[model samples]
Each structure stands twice: as C-alpha cells, then as structure tokens.
Target: MSRLSLHRRLAFYGAAAILLALAAAAMGLTWLFGTHVERRAIAEMEVQLEQVLSGLTIAGGRLTADKLPMDPRYSRPYGGRYWQVQKGGETLRSRSLWDETLSIDGESAPSGDVRIYRQRGPGGTPVLGIERTVRLPATLRGGEAKLTVAMDASELTEARKAFALDLAPSLVLLAALLIGAQLAQQVYGLRPLKQIGRRVSDLRTGRASRMGADWPDEMRPLTNEIDALIEERAADIERARFRAGDLAHGLKTPLQALLGEANRLSEKGDEAAASAIESVADSMLTHVNRELARTRMAARQSGTQARANLAEVAGRVVAVVKRTPDGARLEWTVEAADDLVAVIDPADLAEAIGALAENAARYAEKAVRISARRAKSKLTIRVCDDGPGIPDEDLMRVLERGRRLDEGSVGEGLGLAIATDIAEAARGRLTLEPGKEGLCAVLELTAAGT
Candidate 1:
C-alpha cells in the first residue's frame, strides 16, 4: 500500500551483482592459476629431461652416461626430482629415483617428440613429468631409448594451493572495496530524489506553492510534471467551489419562497396543513445546506495546502462556543500544543472542531474536555463529555445526516455528519467511542511538518 524506497532496493541489487561477479572472478582466477602452475612444472621437467638425455650414449649395446644432472635433489633418494633412461631392456636412472622406477603408460609418440604425463612418485605422491624418445647414432647398434624427468606433482599442487590462499584474502578485500564504492555511488546517484521529496513536503505543508528549480536533468521533467498536477488540481477545486456556490444559491431562493408560502397559509387560518408544509420545507432546506457545506468543505480541503495552529483554533472555538447558554453552564478544559499545525484550512478545521465542541457542550453533565496533539503523520483532536455515553450501535448512526439520537433535542442534525465529511475530505477520519463517563469524538487529520 505504501511506496517503497528506491535507494534501499538499488543498494541490495548492486551488492548482489558485485558478489556474484566476485564469486565468478575468484573461481576463474583459481582455475587459471592451477593450470599455469602445472604447465610450468611440466616445462621445467622437459628441460631437465633434455639435459639428462644429452649425457647418455649407447656403448657396447649398453646405456652409459657422462654426467648426471648437477641438481642436489637428483642425488638424494626421494629428493622430489628424478630422471631415468631405458634402451633394449636396459635401464638407467638418476640417484634421486633410488630403488623406485618410473612407470610409463607407453603412450605412442614419434621419436624425438616429447610427451607429458602424471604418475605417482615416492610415498605415493603425485608426480608430473615429460618423456621423450631419441634415436641413437649407429655407433653401437641403432636403437631408440626413452628418457623421462619428473618432479613430485605435489609441488605444483602446493604452489596452486598457496596462490589460492594468498588470493582469497585479496579478492575478499577487493569485494569489500567494490561494495563500498557501490554504496557511495548509490548515495550520490539518489541524492536528487531526497531533495525532491523535501520540496514536495514543503508543498504539502504550505511552505512552498510549487517545486523549486536546480534539479538534475534526469529529474527535472518529473518535478515539472508534479508542479503541473498541483496547479491543475487547484484549478479544478476552484471551479467546483464556484459551481457549488451557484447551485446552492439557486436552490435556496425556491426553498425560501416555499417557506414564505407556508407562512401565508398559516396566516389564512390553515394552521395544521401550513405547519406540515413548513416542516417539509425546513427539512428540504436542511438537506440543501448540509450538502452545500459538504461540497464546500471538499473544495476547501483540496483547493490549497494550508497549516493551522491547533492550539489557536481550539482556543478560538472554545471562546465562541462557551458564550452559548448550554456551554456557559459547564466547565471547559482545553489542552493543545501551541506550535502543532495540521494540513487543513483554518476555517474548515474550525468548523469541524466547533461541531464537536458544541455537541459536548450540549450533553456534558458537569464538564467538557478538548485536547489536541500530533504524532507521526497524524494530528488528533479529541472532545469528551461527562454525560451518559452513547451505545455502540448508535455511534455510527449519530454521524449520519439528519439522524438524531434524541429527537426531542432542539438542533439541526448536521453537526457530526459535517465534521465527519470534513475529516474525510482532509484524508482522515472521525471515530466516536465510549469515554470514561460519556461519548468521545476523535477527529484525526494529517499533521503539517515544518
């Protein structure tokens, strides 16, 4: 039922997008890093394999070597780097292999070509290596031999693990930074909207008649449209008021002529029929006036945004109503905040409160209490009496036009009904409930904010 805030929604979506992107980036970076580390290990092993092969030659149909790789790891058993050569079922291996043998799957590769693969090493650790076949010069017997250089694959795996460990914190930090930046962007991008809201509030409180300038290009059109709508609404209300006045005047002339005719009949010795005619004419007049008042209240409520001090209006109503015979006999207590203002026309509010105060004055046994205060978006004015309270079912009926709970009481029946219409026109309501000793009438209206 309420308009949701745009800033909060945008922030949520922006953060979600950043989080998903960071997640994808994290996964992609990890994949590329692992692939690179594995390839680098294989390339290094291939170079070592070439070095090991350079030192090998066939002599008397037996494999021989001039020198082995100088790396200290090769001389140490299970030192994590190894090389091996094989020819005609004869085998040669670096000292690093110790008693372990390199197991090749015999994947077919042309001579002088290199193949890369992985295998388990000492302690069942994973190993990455490159293997190649070379053609020996026919110096002894022309033959092909296989040479392989391998280092523990765990090294590359550990490097990738370490890289991920290091990158995780950085990516998390980057996500935080990006999210923070997104928050700032949201604030900056939406600041204009905040300004527009304040200006619109000013319009509602009667501080400004129209939206101000200096808006961003993106929002300027909206502000212009809102200003136009306010102006249009005002014009419509003005014309409505004018039409209502003309119609009420036109109807009042005929009703007054009818009442005059009844008086003439009464003067001519037809007392009973003339009295009935007068009563009917009076009832018709009440209806016309009630409808007219309601229409005028509506036009006034919508025609302008005006703030009225509740304390001042209450004081004025009390001053005028207490002069009556019924109100003068009873004590009156009024409580109102001096600075509290409501978004309603002063005359309209006065008329509404006057109705409640007059009603309380008529029924209160000993005293009447009137209080006004504002909370959040609403301003409440409550009038209570010390007389007998009305029944629950009669509460709503009493506010209907021309419906009186006590027919013997001397009064027009439009007080509560008109007050109810006035409250509704101002986008509020009137609730009649049982008070401690009597009926309480509460008129709630939209409060004005400075």
Candidate 2:
C-alpha cells in the first residue's frame, strides 16, 4: 500500500468529523421542528375543544352543540381534525370522525385541566389529542362529560420529514466549507516543515552551511538542534584532518631516516638487508599516504561548495602521465567536454582521476583513453587501456588495500584502494569492468547543479 501524506491524513479525518457533526445537527434540527409542529397542533386542538364546550346545551334533556368549531376539516371524513363529547351514556362526535372514533382511556382526567394523549384515530391512523372532563352548567342539567379534540399524528411526522429535506443541502454546504477551511489550515501549518526540508537539501549540496534562525516558534528547537549538529560535525572533521596531517608529517622524517640507513647498508655491501629495510620503509610510507589522502577526501565530502571541470581535471592528469616512460610509449585520448562539471573538490577529483589514468598508462600496450559523460545526476569518468584485463573473479580483490596481483610491480598496491576510498567519501563509487580492448576503470561522481 502507498503511504498517506500528512495533508491527506488530516483532510480525511477532518472531513469525517465535519460530516458527522453536520449530520447530527441536521437530525437535531429536524427533531426540534417536529416537536414545535406537534406543540402548535395540540394547542390548536385545545382551542377547538374550548369552542365545542362553550357551544354545548341541553335540549329536550339531550346534549347538543349549538355551534361547532370553525375549521372546515371538522366537516370532512378523516380530515385529520376531530372532536368528541360523552355524557351519561350519550356520545357526540364531529363529522370528520365519520364512523370511527378516538380511542380514550376509561379513567377521567382532572377537572378544568387539559391532558394530552396519543392513540389510534379514524381509519386506524395515529392521532395526538387533548382531553378535558367537566361538569355541565347547573341550568343545563349538571353532570360530568369528557371532551376531546385530536389531529392526526402523521401530520407531525410529515412535517419532520419535510424539515429534514429542506435542511440537507444547507448542511452539506456547511460541511464542505468547514472541510475546506480545515485543509487550508493544515497546509499553512505544515509549510514550515517543507521549508526545513529544502534547507537541509541545500546544506547537503553545499549551497548553505547552516539552518538559519527565524523559524516558527514550534520549529525553533528542532532547527537550532540541527544547526548545532552540523557545526559540531564540521569541527570534528577539521580536527581529524589536522591530526592526520600531523601524524603523516611526524612519520615522514623517521621514514626518511630508515631510507638513509638502508643506503648506508648498501654502501657497506649488505645488499639483502638494505633491500629488506627499503621494502619495509616503503610499505609504511604507502600506508601513511593512503590514510592522509582518505582523511582529506572525507573532509571534502562533509561539505564544500567546490565544482571541478571534468575536461580540465582529465587534461591535467593526462599531461602529467604523458611525462612518464610508459605513458610516452602509449597514445592518450581525452574525450570530455569542457563544460561538464561535478560537485567535488578540484584537487580531490584530480587525485582520483590521476590514480586511475596512471594505472591505465602503466599497463597499456598501445593506447589509453580518458572520457567522461553526464547522465541524469551522475558524472562518470572512465579510463580504459589496451592491455590484458584482470579475470572477473580478481576484479573485486584488486581493489583491496595492499593486495597486488603482481608482486613484481615496483610500487605498493594502494592506488586503486585509495581511489575507491575517495569515491566512497564523495558519496560515489569506483567499479572495474572489461573494456573493448582491456580494462576499464569507471569513477562515478555527483554532477553539479543536480
């Protein structure tokens, strides 16, 4: 599965919460409106019941309404409006009741107070009603009677449905606006993180040395820590380079003294002892040079705004190599464009390339070629020679320090190992492959402006 970004996660959760809240609001509004409609309906029924009670009279010893309620629905069958009166085994109902009646409990309510109820009405539909039991006027034959007026409960239900339908679009629009505002807030909040990322990239590429100040308050602690770490790392690398230089210089004098002793042994006619001492001194010198080179290369890698021209470095190495006896016997070709550049220190680039080119010139039978090209964000420098290349299995072993395939060679086997270390320090690599004629040494480096 793909990872979700911070913005996407925040948007998802925010939208969900907004929708839930709006849905709840919609439900609550619809319920409140339904309760309001029911209350108004019951209040209207109370007024109708009062009118029916006021119009009642005793004629011929029977109860009769001299006047009925004013609503026209009272005259229509099942029109959702109704009235009923009952006294001493007599019952009177509005025409809207038709042959049906409002179901009522046998227990009578308290006098002079109206009570609300819910029960099946005409045609088995539910209705909401108000009831009052009162004593008739003394002049109209004093007796108790129950009066009820009801309206169909379905009216309140329909009113609630209508209210929800009307509210849905507004609720949807509100949710959308809220969600949009939340997304904008999240983007604004996370902008600092993006800026920090770009600044860190600049630091790595040597465009900037430190994470500067004036960050948001929430991000100050983090930025300050990163700046401190970068400073400490640079200081540490500088100190290491100083120590390495001191160690190398201090050992050089002793190595020279050993060489002087070897020469004296040779003068004394002890050739084998002089040869052994010379070999040991040479080996120690080689190790010192290799470490010193590695330290400097690592310092360059830490952070340096240095750009080296590929063509220039290649030409310099070629000119130096051509002065050697083996290079004089071979043809050297340089095939790099002058504009091609890499993000590496000029001296470091020259040293790495010179090591490869010198090795190639030493072994080439006819010709040595130096070429470079930029591919995407990488700059590759290739040095090839027209000589017998090493076997595939021995390619990796040859890069190891002091591991020489041919011990008869004059120099210690540190050239290829030093070149490899330089490449690694610069976040690159060196690889050996079979060329069209013989061996190919490829140095891959980071291209400038990548």
Candidate 3:
C-alpha cells in the first residue's frame, strides 16, 4: 500500500489498466470475428439453397434435384454440408445428409422467403442453416416446397478458436509496448521531484541558497512555497541572532564597569571586597561570552557555507596562546597537516581551538601539544597537555557551563562548554579523555569535500 513509491504505484495502475483494456479488446475482436464467420457461412448456405431450388423437378411423380451444388462435401455422406427439398409428402436431400436429416421447427412463413436458424444436422451435431419455401410453377401441379442448406456449426467454433490463437501473440506484444511506455512516462514525470529532493539536501548542507524556479508547471507552486518558507525561516533566524548579539553587547559594558569598580576597591585597600566583586564580574563576563559563542554557532547552523583549514586555525590559536604568560613557559607542539580542512566557519574553529589551547597552556607542567588529522569524512583535532587530568567522574561535569574543578583558575569554566556547542552545531562532537601524561581534548568536525 502506502509503502509503495509513486513510480511503483503508477506502474501498477497503468499496467493493470492496459491489461484490462487488452482483455476487453481481445474479447471484442473474437466476437466480431465469430460474427463475420457466421455471416459468411450463412451467405454460402443461401447460395446452396438457391441451387437446390433451381434443380427441383418432378420425376416419376417424386420430387428430386437434377442439379447438385459443386462442393465435393455434398457428394460425401456426413461431410457437414447438406441440402434438402420437401413438397407434397415427397422429400429430396443431398448425398451428404445420407439417411439423417436436419431438424427444423414447424413454424409457418411466406413462400420464397429465406430464413436462417440453428438446429441439429446429420450425426446430431449443431449446424447453421438457411431455409426457404418456394412456390412450384403451374406447368407441374402447383405446390410449395421447403428448401434447406446447412453446414456444421462446430466448424465456425473451430475457426473462432483459431482466430483467437492467431490474435494472442500480437495482443500480448501490444500490451508489453503499452506498459513500457507507461513506466517511461512515470520516470520522466517524477524526475523533477527527485531533483527537488537533492536541491533541498544541498540547502540543508549550505551548498545551495534557493530551491530555484526551473520546474514543470504542475510543480511550480509547490517549489515556490518551499522556497518562500526557507526565506522566511532564514529571516527569522537572522533577527533572533541580531537580538542575541545586541543583548550580549549590552551586558558587556556593565560587566566591564563592575571590573573597574573592583580595581578601585583594591586601590582603596578593601582586598576581600575587591576579590568578591572581581569574581562576580568575571563570572558575568564568562556567561556573556558563552552566549555570543552560541549565537555564532546558531548562525553557522542556518545554512552558511563554511570551510576552515585545520592547520591554519590550529596554528593561529597556538600562536596567540604562546603570547600568554603561562603558555611562554611551556613547550608547545603543533602537528596538523595543511591539507586537512573542516566544514565549519574559520572564526568559530579558531575560537573553539583557542579555548582548548588556553586551558592546556594554563595547566601544562612542561608541554602542550596540538595535532589534527582527516579520516574519511571527519576531521579530528586533539589538544593534549602534560598536566594533572580531571577524574573520569568529573569529566562530564567539566563540560557544563560555569562548572570549575578549581576555583583558583583564572577562567570561569565556559571554555569546554562553548567548544562543545560549536562542535555540535557543525554536526560533530567534543570529547575529553586521558592522554599518556595529561588531559586530551578531542574536537571532531565534519570534513570538507566529503
């Protein structure tokens, strides 16, 4: 039922309709052929009846036919052709009838008028018959004689069977051609829908911007509606992203003022109050940064074409981190191939890698290593640090926004959380695992050109 595709459904219905029509056609043709055969048989019998009437004579006061029909069957007994003439209790019949006779109904009719009927003949087989009552001339004692000529009805039946057999192969061939044409029509008709499906997939993957207008008249309205919906959805997302950016920017000045107040408190020698104010300001700023990262990820997800070289983005993050105080003291290694590219915005990729690199720099006792590789359809970037790694139980907890294992760390603990959001938006993932001598952050994103 419903599981059948449109092509299959159309093929089924078309083939069924063709078969039914052909079946009806076969029957109609067979019937017409049978009617034609019967008419031809009756016409021949009419000619024989006329010949029988013309040959009628009274010889030795008995009715007899002096001239016989030319067909050879009339000379053979039970040859399926017959003629008879009867008048005044005297009867004359063709030799083909032998001692048997045709059975006719006793219905009366006008003289010289011919009638056609179905009745039993010699050997009790069915026969198609033509009969007439003819008036005798006055030279002889005037009287009317009934004449009949018949052939076996089975011959007509056999002819019809033969005709159908002859017609079968041609009809079957016609049905095949018709069904093939129907399937071809279905494939041609549905090709547009397949193209629409592929185009819609391209839109989802940021490969195409619109559904386009090159469609059949029947499909134009549907494609137009889909394109309109896509435009409306994109407009709505753009507005929402703008509002989010405005809100994040609005909160930034307040958080900076709070930090400024904290610095004044420190100058006034209120150390405890300054530390508390700075903590609150840093925490609020972290939240704002997290929101901005989310807004960027959302915009990337809304069908923006994005491709970033893994090596380039990783190099940028490492170079920036190297300038930090903690990063300058640690040995840093970057091991990414230049050819490896990921399907994500270059800016988003840089920010995500920066978060991981900064965390590695802050905690590494001796070394921080960044490496990337491309495998089939995915890009894997790993940032490893030779530092005390978090326990397995706390690994999942660290990815939650604002959750930190150590309160003394300068970061407010949104780095991994923001990175995770960006990875998921790119149809990838972020995972943390224990490396040989430290924590390893693995960021997997979709590979470009895959």
Query: Which candidate number has the best lDDT?
Result: 2
Estimate, for each residue in 1-450, the C-alpha lDDT of model 2 and write its tens digit: 759988898899889999988988888888889888888888888888989999998788788988899999999988889999988788899999998777786666898888899888888898889999998889768888899999989988988998898888888889889998998899999899899999888777655668899799989999999988877777876787789879988998999999999999999999999999999998888788887887777666664446789999889888998999988899999999988988777878888998898888878899999999999988999999999888999999999987888788878888898899888877789999999989999999888777
In model 2, the runs with Cα more than 4 Å from the true position are 1-12, 57-63, 86-92, 98-113, 120-124, 132-146, 165-229, 263-272, 292-339, 345-347, 364-370, 384-400, 403-406, 432-440
Q: Number of clashes in model 2?
A: 0
Instruction: List CA RMSD, all candidates.
Output: 6.7, 4.8, 3.6
Preferred candidate (TM-score higher): 1 or 3: 3
lDDT of every predicted structure (CA atoms): 0.84, 0.87, 0.86
Instruction: Give the RMSD in angstroms, all C-alphas superposed, for model 2.
Output: 4.8
Where model 1 places Cα greater than 4 Å from the true spot, the runs are 1-23, 57-63, 120-125, 137-143, 175-243, 260-279, 296-342, 346-411, 427-447
Which digits, one per residue and each the tens of the lDDT, describe model 3 over residues 1-450?
599988888999899999999999999999999999999988888887888777777688766788889999998999888988877677788899888777698684578787888877788799888888888886546888788898989999999999999999999999999999989888888999899999877666655667889999998899899889877777766786788779977887888888899899999999999999988887777777787878767765764456889888888888888898989899989999889988888988998999998888878999999999888878899999999998999888888977889888777788888899889998889999999988999999887766
- How displaced is residue 33 in candidate 2, in Å? 2.0
Instruction: Please estimate how well model 2 matches the true structure, expressed as its whole-model Cα lDDT.
Output: 0.87
Score candidate 3 by lDDT.
0.86
- Candidate 1 lDDT, tens digit per residue, 217-297? 989899999888887878987887788889988988888898888889899999998888888887787677678778777
Q: What is the lDDT of residue 296 in candidate 2?
A: 77
Position 432, candidate 3: lDDT: 94
